[model samples]
Target: MAATLNEIYNARSIALIGASQDPNKAGYQVLKLLLDEGYEGKVYPVHPKEPEILGRKCYPSILDIPDAVDVMVVAVSAKVVINVMKQAEQRGDVKGAVVLSAGFAETGVPELVEAEAELVRIAKRAGIRVFGPNCIGMAYPALKLNTGFAPGIKLIEGSAAYVSQSGAFGGALLMFAGDQPCPQGFAKFGHIGNMCDVSNLELIEAFNNDPSVSVTGAYMEAVKDGRELMRIAAASEKPNLILKVGRSSLGAAAAMSHTGSLAGSDKVYDGAFKQCGIVRMDTVEDMTDGMKAVASLPKPKGNRVCVLTEAGGMGIVSMDTIDKTDLVLASIAGDTLAKLEETLPSMAMICKPDGYIDMTAAVSPEQQAESLRLVLADPGVDAVLLMGLPPIFRDAKDTAERISPVAKEFDKPVAVCFMRGESMAEGRRHFEENGIMTFDTPERAVKALETLYRAAFRNGHPLEDLPPAPRHHLVEKAVAQGRNLLEPEAVSLLADNGIPTVDHAFATSSEEAQDAAERFGGPVVLKVVSPDVIHKSDAGGVKVNIRSRSEMADAYDAMMSEVASRVPGADIHGAMIVPLAEPGTEIIIGMVRDPQFGPTIMFGLGGIFVEVFKDVSFRVAPFNEEVALDMIKETKAFELLGGVRGETARDVGSLVDLLVKVSRMAATQPEISEIDLNPVRIYERGLAVLDARIILSCGN
Candidate 1:
């Protein structure tokens, strides 16, 4: 990865390719913004038609420019972009080029894609790093250099660097950040148009090493190299916040059209994010707010919090919100409680939030200040939440000023939530001006606190090595057969990989079925096995819990009759008889090839609840134990697996092990298209696969 925009903030000069005299064009804006931002570096505008842009002399081409340009901004048509890039490569002094044009692989046009590829090849050969093929350009606020068409009058000087795939979305977020009370800064918003050579992962790695950037945030439609992104994010010392769009089918389609990216399933992305310890947010607001909170707030020693509120109702709401955030309300210590009692009348209760603070007690500024001091001094409290203070008391400004110094003494985070409109406005302004974090609502305050809390706990766990891929006995034959494996065959294949499956034998006739049942055990299960009868239960092709040979024969006959009636054209493979397996718990583990993300593994509660509850978690193939455990815990089934109502806990350890094995198998074998292990029975001592289906990839 090359140095990020922040690392090269002191670049001596920049060359503007396709510079134009027309102020309305993006090229003109690029030249104008650089000048307006007070970039100290010399600016060279390369244009064939214009001799001067914004009163600065413009050269006809890069070859004509006397001084070496550190960075070149290519804002030209797609047809001429290649030419501009070629000229940039020939320049010995140019270190990097930002391609601000759009026509690339995103158009899904063959010529444009080929052209973009050639541009990358040229840059690589010349040792010139390329930023984008379709991007809005770049900006470095610290140096007052803006290479993009978008102006930066609203941008405030801060320590966070942002990157995005969508130029408009980046601009919108920058605009939104301008309105926020906290001072937000961006080294540059690199709109990585089509990510021809430079990718989000590379940028993240660069930012991770950049000293100026204290925190990093990204808004991505899709990740080109998910594995690399995970690695960088996991290793980053600074907080990495991500707001990924295109999780839904409709959104994924839009992302594909916008960036020529294949946005993967939401579940897969979620699992990857969790494993990487990236702070994931749903909206831009959350992303901005989360970044601000993580950057500005002091880390809480613990989740314990003390809520100080004037109104009882607001206190209750605050407590409820706190509970949802997984933070514990600190119990009022005896000395702190005594100090509060001394400051207030008997009517004022000083317990937690709901504890007493009399509203009509004619509170004085000195008394209010003293009460806040007592709360801050409490050894039991790690943080304090002051809520519902009306502006009428002292204009909220004076009150905040008086309490700010005392709150700082304890070195603890203090969040304020005002219910009244005027009070909130006054309080927010005062707190922000004084660098004291405040929120409009208790929920928002709790959310901010939660981000910090999670970041603290997210001490990156070491990535465990995944077990080697399991060997399957059925892959070669199934591929040769050019057909999906039946349940019996699939089970046999799984059994070969050390997966436990019930002992069973294929019976060609009713007499054979009875003989097989007696050979296996007296009590056995009979199921009509055929490739066409995928859903045996739906077709009434399965019978279980048979006690005798006669019962087994009857079940065999009934299963055959039901299959024949259900699908008259289907060929009967014959009945399978196995000893009745002890049923403890049921779970499902399956695999399907995702068009964008390749092999994906799914785990959930087995049977009817699988669809009804939609309780499933997914992870991309070749996952370690930690990743597999994260997937298992993501589903509501985790509660059941943990043992509800005195039930013995299921073998979650074994289940995760099995999932890891399956994921590796999927990753190693391209011939396997889909693998379904439904209703795998979990016993007290062991596990048994009751059914399976393996669908080979087409032409395998």
Candidate 2:
């Protein structure tokens, strides 16, 4: 990977294999681009057919070139790439090779795949890095370098560096960057074709460590080393904007065929991105929006945003957008209101969406700047959104420039939304040029502000360290027996681990069930335990709240009969007679091993709503109490836990502790495949696991 980056950056002398004199050929275009783009490097065209091409002495082969080349760009056929590479490797100074040839594994051609693999192996042996077998190559704008056949265009030089797997996509992004009116930033856009060695993770890590780069963006089809990427993203302080294509099933299949990638489940990607703190965007526009926001906006103190707009409708829209995100609309502080009162009319309403400021009456830049300054000074406002009407302000550009310095003075992120059409383009450009984030629409501005707030706040509040998990007795026994834990076994394991479970006893027969129910006391619960039936409730294998021994005996028989009827071929492992747990707030605590982020803990409203409502929050495993508490509070069900209506708030602290413990367990035990503790009853005093299941790795 070091070799790859160096080869791309410091290629003082390059050998272009299959170089042609014909102007229309890709080889000719590549050489022309290098010269046109002001690449200071020397060029050696390797062509067996021509003695001289493009006003330069052409070598028959790389071996024949008198001078050693720093990098080799192979544009020959796939079959000839290896041969060319072998010749290039013979040169002592040949450090890296970018194979622009196609017909690799992407075509699903067996022979070509082998040829590509051989190219990788030869390059590896030669200690030379390979870029792509089917790629658009790379460009370094700051250095004025262009290596592939892609067109020569002015690449934006700033902080954001972009990497993609698709050559066409990378080229398109470069072209878009050149065309779009974006903030100045250094960008390293490249394609990772047939990533045999160099991968997305390596590039991200490089950019993250690079002093020139302040932010990183990626358009990845699939992660080659997901764990490595997650680790890098999680540890890096720079904001990362990732747009992962092929999120849907159809798109995943298409991506698989296009790049030979495994675009895993969307849920897994969501969990992984959340855990790593990587801002995931759905489209290219969103990616740019996020990047611009990060580049221009100041780090917000918190997620609370205060909107001060001239148009009430735009303010309402901004409020709606804020509600959609994690950002809260802060109440106006008294000092802020007082400041605004002196500047504005008596009838002005200075609330959260403080749009009562008369923009029509104030045509002066000073008035607009004063309005903005007053809003930003509010102690409760962490960030401010200003919706500017270009037609109303006489000097829109002056107003934008004036507002920028005042916003900086207050040390707050002030985003401007130009409500007018192309007429406001000048004003928008002025604001953007002055480092004030300006968006075309209110929603876009709000989104950028929200992302800025999230990135800023996320930096300080790191995931907390988790508590020690309870030892699972049944899990240990099951590990010895080489079996998955059913509900009863899982419950016993939870009890062993220090997690409270409802008191239960295994019964082999109806008579035993009756006896166990008598011993357990009133309101017994009967559940038929079977190795084959993981979802007992769904299979009619569970019977809850049996008051008497007679009821228990009948329920045990009925549950067994029902389970047998429903499953038909399931082998019942007898019944579990337990004391019925008192009704309380039901919550779920589960662990899923995310492919990219490793183990992740999930918390949400438990019971059937866990699936139906899908109100869940996730954090990477090994989280501390603080992180666990944040995850719990982040959920919509937090209101319920805080005693909604007449209900008493459950012991949320206990739940957070339990989550931390579970996360630690997941992190420590690699063999534990999954942990599902549904309906973890949260009482005012404590919590109890009503049902649990632990699925261990098959190898374990």
Candidate 3:
């Protein structure tokens, strides 16, 4: 059981169990931070040896304290932590605890692990939520409570709540708050180490509910329940920025050793995060900076942004970078263009109707601010990127002040890039202090706006909540059979789930293969059907475009012989023959059961494109037609499907329908672990599943 966030953060009385007078000890720092931060809550220092500490009488234990303690801070040795927690548990008034000690389960020692477990058991029995047996702890700037041991740090007042898995990282982020520009400082900071009781999801939910906390940032190595996190993220309107590490094999192992957390499949995490509208950040710097920007600005209504720069080269650079992202150069509105043309100097050029607003170096800070004000007011533009304005001119501070009021007036986002200047630091500080997001480069400013636009779009059009998939009996029957499904069986299962599959007939022998090919009366594709074989092509078990009995017979014999040589002990389960469909673009639809996020669906250009380009897009299961369409468009090769080079467009609606059905099947059928429908040819009006391989879970 976990204690409510209110009990932990808004506690009226807090007790520091091992409060010390020594300057070197963490306990001493914790007490000093609480007092120095101007915490309004009652503080009790429980130390047996000290008569008084920091001008306050020290109690022997939590029980000895005269008043009730809402939260207890335990910074003691591993040997005595259990006893301290037990005493707090017996006190009954302690609603929650922040344990600042190590050498527990993370040490991988049995006795220490048992000791931590016992501490948790006592806390749970006593109805007290615990933060960590090994963590830096929590800091609530709004309450002026600093329970962690980072010295000489002043908490910032901001709307973004950051919770980190690593205590040291959390401390660093908090310390670096002076560099991050926000209207206020951070709403709160937490280091949820080990998460034996209170989890990251709970902390996220708490912040999500806080009206003041507009955005939440997390540095999570792993999550205990990905589904719950997704659910909470989906339900909350607040944007979440997450920097999820431990993606590579080496990083995963390191994360496990560091926190005893299993960093699950990175692909699944990506899909789930996108599905739930949580913005996935690439690095801690990105997360921290992005959260600051997102928390301050209004959600851009669209991805269209207009770049304003006094320097022509900076404008060009900003436009080039914006082109690479999901953002687009917005078309300037006629009225806004007219206003710019009237107000600008003769040398100024409103050259691009879409994207860049070129106000030459001759333009003053006042003219620049006016141009920005008009552009931000334009209906076509959702956001504006001010590049190299104040930095180039000597009046950086005055320019920032001039632009600040206009930026705050508009509902859209405004980002500024200080390319270079002697007053770079002072100008940025001024702009940030006045509520404008400032970046060092044009590219970074554009990148921040792109992130804001994406978060806005996702939040507006959220992922659909699909009902539980209807029972799939075909899948149940296949799982009952103790082996992976053959191609024919996999195709049948797909068809049963309303996903279109090619018509096919199975044959056990060469003569039967010939008969089956003859039945098709045209060129047919023949593939070896073996549950034991995963990659049939690698084993030479596939032969395509067989037109006659002789060819079919030769292909069958060659396939069997090749399989025998390639995969010696594999069991042969006959062959499947289907009519060769018209030549068209190929698409690959796949599903993999991720350990943490359950099923995830993938779509990409099939055939060699999948292998050579590796351009694929993934989304969590239960996705709808709209989501499937987005997945299809996310691929780099989407232009090929959209009738590139004067080619006729394939039936994209049919492809989308197929993707949705496959997603449903994956979500509903836990027995099926992986499904690969490769080279699903898309013709003028229809598509055919050329091949399918579905592997059942061994656990089933």
Candidate 4:
């Protein structure tokens, strides 16, 4: 049977090939690290020449090793790497392999790429789960193992598991981190280069299931399957923080619809991560900051944070930083604020601006603890961010000692920012020793609290509804007709899915338009319906405010003429004649099928606001009601929906229902590429979907 993840990654015994006496070589360096770190397992070295290296007996090959090997570490040239795998297969003692060789797919050479693929095939047949052919390696410090050849990289035993895409650069970065006094530590570390064998998703799945992993992180250049990533990250209970690079625009030249035009790949990733409870880190520094908070602190109850500072500048800086994050300053209770004012020093400014406190340098260690207890007990506070400078007279250690116990009394997380390195060194040391995280800068400290909040609040709130079955007929019809669904057909589909569109009638002539207008006994709107014309307004095919028969006739003639001149040789269908929707808030609900992540729903302000501001939010298909409401609240349109400018509140609950139904429709209909419902007039009681467009992918 194939080895499980624990057997493969947490192997008790290892066979290190290319064992060398030369310290400069990677093989020699790797052996020294393993032996020096006191790996709690048997070390079997394989070498053709050296009989004994670093006090470990060397065999010519793994096949010659007498003891059963739980895993094999191959550090050899690319040309001869397959030969080692052959030996691993023949040995039968090998359970897993970590090929440390380069010159595979990473080189972008055709021959090397094929060689890597062939390597996976061979390893799979032998039931050996291979890590990398052009990668650094793996490290599980709890097991006292550092299997990679990256020298000077310290793997501290922590709850976070880190995976990287680039081995050399990633490994060097980790090495740099290790060189520092307080390095960014991890429980498991490895790089999945080229990913011909094991991918980042596989590692994420492994981490998600592993009990030892408290939170997970990765450095990804690009993702091949964003849908699967959403699924895996959504399922993971622990926080999944990823530093996704390549935030530039997509490679596509143009899009068929507005939904596709605004669907930047990076935006899709951002929205998908938010929906799935993945913490998207911006830089390597951000990852380090997020890791410390996620690893050390307790999960915060909410995003509300109270900032307590010994310096005014630090408090100001912290509040400014909090303004940009998902975190909000906690509104200290009135009674609590009164207590803080009475107990603290005369210089202390209590709640001068909402959730802030300026204790000044005059405060002592005892007062600090008392203040911490008061805020921790307050119902408004969910977390605490304490910023302290060097005390004027008292020792810094005294402040740390007094505050640590009070901070630990409550389950809420606390992040300490102690500035002036050497001056506050004792205080910072005490905080670290007491299991409270410390940061040098106010920005980094704020980030730690923000990450903690997201972990506790944003992670894993996905809707459990199963995806509806795919509608094959719609795809087949679109393909057979060689065009996307018509506006009428799109409207019909929405109605079938229980979304109410406007009252309208199809009109080929001006008489039909007038008749449709008379049915409403008010002004009507004429929108050209054609599968060929995606943008009716851009093509001069839309006419509104037609009151009488004469106006309808004139508008019909002018619109047809303009459309003909603008788009020549286009097959034009009849226009949709409907009553002008009652005045209400306009919203744009759309769906864009991302290449990596399929069918994502978008919500934002309608008309010019969406076009100009691009203020929108997205959720993956078939999301829950909570996710749906979050998407609405994330955009500027949310304010307008909640009775803006003396207007009555629009039907937000009805809108949420509409969004859920649309998400289900998009999720079930796999052939659909885009769904745009622009100028969806949302009233106080109901909504009117004035225009609808659904694009189907014929590529299948």
- TM-score for each of the candidates: 0.88, 0.88, 0.92, 0.93
Off by over 4 Å in 2: 1-7, 22-25, 51-54, 149-153, 180-183, 248-264, 304-313, 330-358, 376-381, 392-410, 419-422, 460-482
| Cand. 1 Cα-lDDT | 0.73
- Predicted model with the maximum TM-score: 4
What residue runs in model 3 are displaced by over 4 Å at the alpha carbon? 1-3, 180-184, 249-264, 338-342, 389-393, 419-422, 460-481
TM-score of 2: 0.88
In candidate 2, list every pair of residues with a backbone clash. Answer: 157-185, 157-186, 158-185, 158-186, 159-185, 159-186, 464-624, 465-624, 470-497, 471-497
Error of 4 at 434 (Å): 1.2
Q: At residue 246, what lDDT does model 1 achieve?
A: 78
Clashing pairs in 3: 3-129, 156-185, 157-184, 157-185, 158-184, 158-185
The residue-by-residue lDDT of candidate 4 on 1-700, one tens digit each, is 6787678777888999887899877789888889999898888988998889989899998888888899988888999899998988888768888888889988888998889888988888899988887776688888778877765677677687888887765676566445432555677877877677788898887887888889888888888888788778878878898889887654463266566667778888888899888888887767777877888898887889999998999999999999999899899998998899888999888888888999998888888899999999998998899988865587888889999999889988888998846778778778877888888789988987887777777655554446666565655677797788878778878887899987778888878887888787898889888777777889998999989888888999999899989988778888898888889898999998777877888898886577788888888787878888989999878898998679899999989999999998888877777889997889999999988888877631
For model 3, the run of ten residues with the poorest summed lDDT: 254-263
Candidate 4 segments whose C-alpha is farther than 4 A from its true place: 168-185, 333-342, 391-394, 459-476, 510-521
lDDT of model 3 at position 208 = 90
Using alpha carbons, what is the TM-score of model 3?
Answer: 0.92
lDDT of 2 by residue, 427-519 (tens): 877777777877768888888887787666553234444444454566667778777777777776666556767788898899999998888
User: What are the Cα lDDT values of the candidates?
Assistant: 0.73, 0.74, 0.80, 0.83
How does candidate 4 fare on TM-score? 0.93
